[model samples]
Target: MATTTTTRSFLQAVATEEVATPLRVVQMEGLVILKIIKHCKDHSPSLVTGQLLGLDVGSVLEVTNCFPFPMREDDEEIEADGANYQLEMMRCLREVNVDNNTVGWYQSTLLGSYQTVELIETFMNYQENIRRCVCIIYDPSRADQGVLALKALKLSDSFMELYRSNNFTGEKLREKNLSWVDIFEEIPIKVSNSALISAFMTELEPDTPVTQCDYDRLQLSTSSLMERNMEFLIECMDDLSLEQQKFQFHYRSLSRQQAQQQAWLQKRRAENMSRRAAGEEPLPEEDPANPIFKPLPEPSRLESFLITNQISNYCNQINGVAGQSFNRLYLMKALHEE
Candidate 1:
């Protein structure tokens, strides 16, 4: 029988749609991982599916005793029963699989860009930084190549247009902090739903960079934007307005490659679901809608934010910190990586 897929929202920041391109990167890695496991697959191999997949933990032993049994009903009292319960819970916790599969699920767990940043940090840490005997993750430069499973180009034009269609210049957006209100300051935040706003305000922990303080202080929750990380989110109108009159080739292709990668992930996920329904083994950790992929498409400078006038914004096209750094060899990186 086909297992019903989980529908709970796995990510807390950006919606699945917005970061679809990046998620494809994870999907490709999962496929590689699955293949690797199967390569060593012996019916009685060294690792069981649960061990490899990180799911086969100890079975549950729902309390067999009825009514706080062993705790004298009439003796309403100070027996050490509570202490025993706590000990048993601790034992169960110990059996938790300390494996990569469970941890990797969160690499693309949809904390929006927050988790993405952490994932990048994990894979990009290097031998030059710290040499070890274990397998080192591929460098950031090679991330897109490893994520061979995604076809993210199909939506490139649509998403690129999203940033482009609403194009506005940084000149229009006075040099101010990028708070939610400031972004939409041309329009103040208002709501007919207090509950959502209250919920949003509650979730705003002090974990983001100092720059996001304005958003942290503001009240927002039920808002449509709670799904997105405010830092990665640009002033849509301002982003387009600020686009340089000139466009570079690499940045353009990165945008398209991102779109292609997302498409590929979606296709693979559908097939995986079919495979599961046919009574094949349930696969490794991954959300079908997400496919857990991210293609490391590097951006070209000259075409994207690198304007002849030296104007720019850290753009969605490049997926890096924004600033004057955009001007440095936008074309060269694109040419080299492409």
Candidate 2:
């Protein structure tokens, strides 16, 4: 009871702190970093997710260890087994006096498709259980292009509340002023290494001479990335258009049904009035129209917003890759003229 009280008090204090100060820093150990990279590379094109073990000191989360969960088609079964495995692993870690608490989990993404429902569900689960949990995203595809992209993300307070309420209604979203950007906040990550480890790494370095023209990074090797991003963007646009068409169709159908209902009601009332004027019994004054056309349920706008955000991401990536290719072309032209 005392421990529970202490934890609650600590959490309350954290909640009272300025929302801008969430996740001040993420300190990742070298071994943990290597393990995550290796796991992601081994999976290659397939998406993989894993659990992280760490300690939270003040606002900084220190990740000391991690383990990858195998890729499986049965997500529901895998989730159950994953939870059991985490529990067992934490138990063993505690026996060895290692940090056993789960700070967050990591997922591998292809391009930027990690902005999907499954990923959001996982983040929500973690945040509900662990107040300061973060989702670390590792993009192996981008890494293969000479850019190692790892980002730490957590849901903002307003987004979290919106998710908890399970109400994705338009009115609620607008009232909260919530947008795609407000859904998640990226936290800065700092890799930490010890002096002994640094010394060992330095000793392991090759003694070969290095040249200054090591421009491998500037090579126009983004053809695959550019093609994929363009394809994905086009597909997303088609999906967005389809959703809009469905919404418009629903609105037109609703308006027509409403007009028919009004006509039916007016006709019934006029008939009853003529019967009464002729000293005949009038029909009951209850509604006589069918309830089948009562407005169809509103389609959730969550999917539309997600597709828009994804389209935006693809555009940004294409622009960046195109810029790099143009720079390389300009360099080649200058060299040829010279």
Candidate 3:
């Protein structure tokens, strides 16, 4: 009875606590970062996801640990097994006195191709249980270019509200002041290490000024990355054009319906005038059963917005990689001349 009462009190405290604190930073442990990197790199080119465990502090999410989910087929029974596995893992961690609270999940992306409707749906699912959550995206392919290529992202508040309502019409989007770029907000990642680990890393530091990582930064091979980005960008542009065609078709149909309705109304008015002139009761000006009077549904703009966002992301990636590649080539040229 006492244990039950304590559990109830704890639940009440958590329920009453404010969950609207906007997350400003993601403080991740160095060990957790290494684990994520290893898990992602181990299955490169094949996407993988893992759950993050952490504590939610004021304006900061401290990610202390994480565990990878086993890859399984998409079946009902398999899904159930996956859920059971997650619960078992959490229970085991709790036994070991570890922070087992689910903060979010991390996933591997190929060349930064992580923006999609599926990702948005995943965010929505996580947000349902956790008041605030973030997806840590690691692009293993991009990391080859000497960049960490890891980022934390969450759906913007306005975007989430609009998504929940399932309304992405032009008027609603304008009212919310949400554009394609406003869909996802990226939070800065701060790596934290314990004193012992910090000291260990300091001892491991090399005496040489130039390291292999510096050599990687100067590598002038970015053609493949740029090619892939351009290909994806072109595909997105085609998709955007198709979405525009859908809106065009809808508008055309709407205009034709309006024209038909106007003609029918004029004909009814003329008939009513003749009946009145003949000293008879005129018919009603409006007919509820008329097919032309039915309102046409507007096409949803959500898909188009996402496609545009993806295109912008691809463009930015290409731009950054190309700029770096050019600088590297110039440095190489100067070194050869010297």
Candidate 4:
């Protein structure tokens, strides 16, 4: 009886702790960051994912280590093998005294295109097992422009609740006060290193004031990235327009149905009056068999919200890159004059 009571108390305490402390920040080890960068860069253009191992303490999710998921076909057998591979890798890491707790997963994105239905579905799948988890997105393509394009994102609580209900009607969205921007909440990432590792990095630093990386940062060739962003932005706009058309079509059909129902009701009431004048039983005003009286289904706005979010992200990226390019061009012009 004592042991059972202790176990129950412990479980209750854990549940209360989780509910009280929501994830606010992601603390990633410097070595883990480097490993993620290496894995993503090594598979540039071809997207890849890796599982993060870490400790979840208080409001901070600490990512200490990560291992890449092997590339495999989409077949069920291959996916089953992938699952076994992950189990084996985690077992080995545990044996080596590493932090093997699955905090979250990281994936490489192409040109900042990580917002999608598939990503949401993946988050839902992870949420089934983990109470709260984040996806660390590394954009290798954007990194080429001298930017560390790493983002840690999680689905917003309200959005997740709405998503789980599978109801994205305008009314439901309004009730939740959820917009496209609320879909993903980005948690700030803090990279940390142990004392020994920090000392080692300090010693390895070169004496030069300027390096190859600094030169690469000043490169003015951003036309390709800009063009690609514009192309994607246009595609998203088209998709958004399509979604709007669907809503418009739905509204039109609804209006027509309403009009038909009104006309039928009026006609039925007139017949009822004639039957009353003849001292006969009045007919019913509503027709349960009529399809026009049935309510029209509203179109889900989830797709439109996602497209809008993607468009906003693309615009912000383009603006940042353009601003940097302009600064570089002006600096080059001043240098040439000198």
Clashes (backbone N, CA, C under 3 Å), per candidate, total 36, 0, 0, 0
Best by TM-score: 4
Clashing pairs in 4: none
TM-score of 1: 0.17
Query: How large an RMSD does model 4 have?
Result: 3.3
- Write the residue-wise lDDT of candidate 2 on 1-338 in tens digits: 99999999999988877463456889888878888989999998898888898988877998888888777556898879977876887788789887788899988888877777777788887777887888888988877555667888877789778877777767788999998767767889989887898999889876765522234456667788888988999999999999899789878987887787778778878999999999999886556456744556767767777788788878888887788789889988999899
Whole-model lDDT per candidate: 0.30, 0.81, 0.91, 0.91
Off by over 4 Å in 1: 1-338
Q: Estimate TM-scores for all models.
A: 0.17, 0.81, 0.92, 0.93
Name the candidate that leads on lDDT. Answer: 4
Candidate 1 lDDT over 248-317, as tens digits, reads 4545765776687667766767877998889787555444455324443333321232222111221332
Q: Lowest lDDT 10-mer window, candidate 4?
A: 14-23
Off by over 4 Å in 4: 1-18
Summarize candidate 3's per-residue lDDT along 1-338 as a digit string, tens digits: 99999999999889867456789999999988898999999998799999999999989999999999988578999999999999999999999988979999999998777888999999999999998799999998888788888899999998999999999888898898888889999999999999999999899999999988787787777788788888988988999999999999999999999899889999999999999999999999888898888888889998998888888888889889988988988888999999
Give lDDT: candidate 2, residue 32.
82
Question: Model 3 misses residue 234 by how many Å?
Answer: 1.0
> Candidate 4, residues 1-338: lDDT per residue as tens digits?
99999999999998886565878899999988999999999988899999999998889999999999998578999999999999999999999999978988999998888889999999999989987788999999988777888899999999989999999988988988888999999999999999999999899999999977777688889899899999999998999999999999999998899999999999999999999999999998888889887778899898899999999999999999989998999999999999
TM accuracy, model 4: 0.93
State candidate 2's TM-score: 0.81
- Per-residue error for 271 in candidate 2, Å, reads 6.1
Worst 10 residues of 3 by lDDT: 13-22
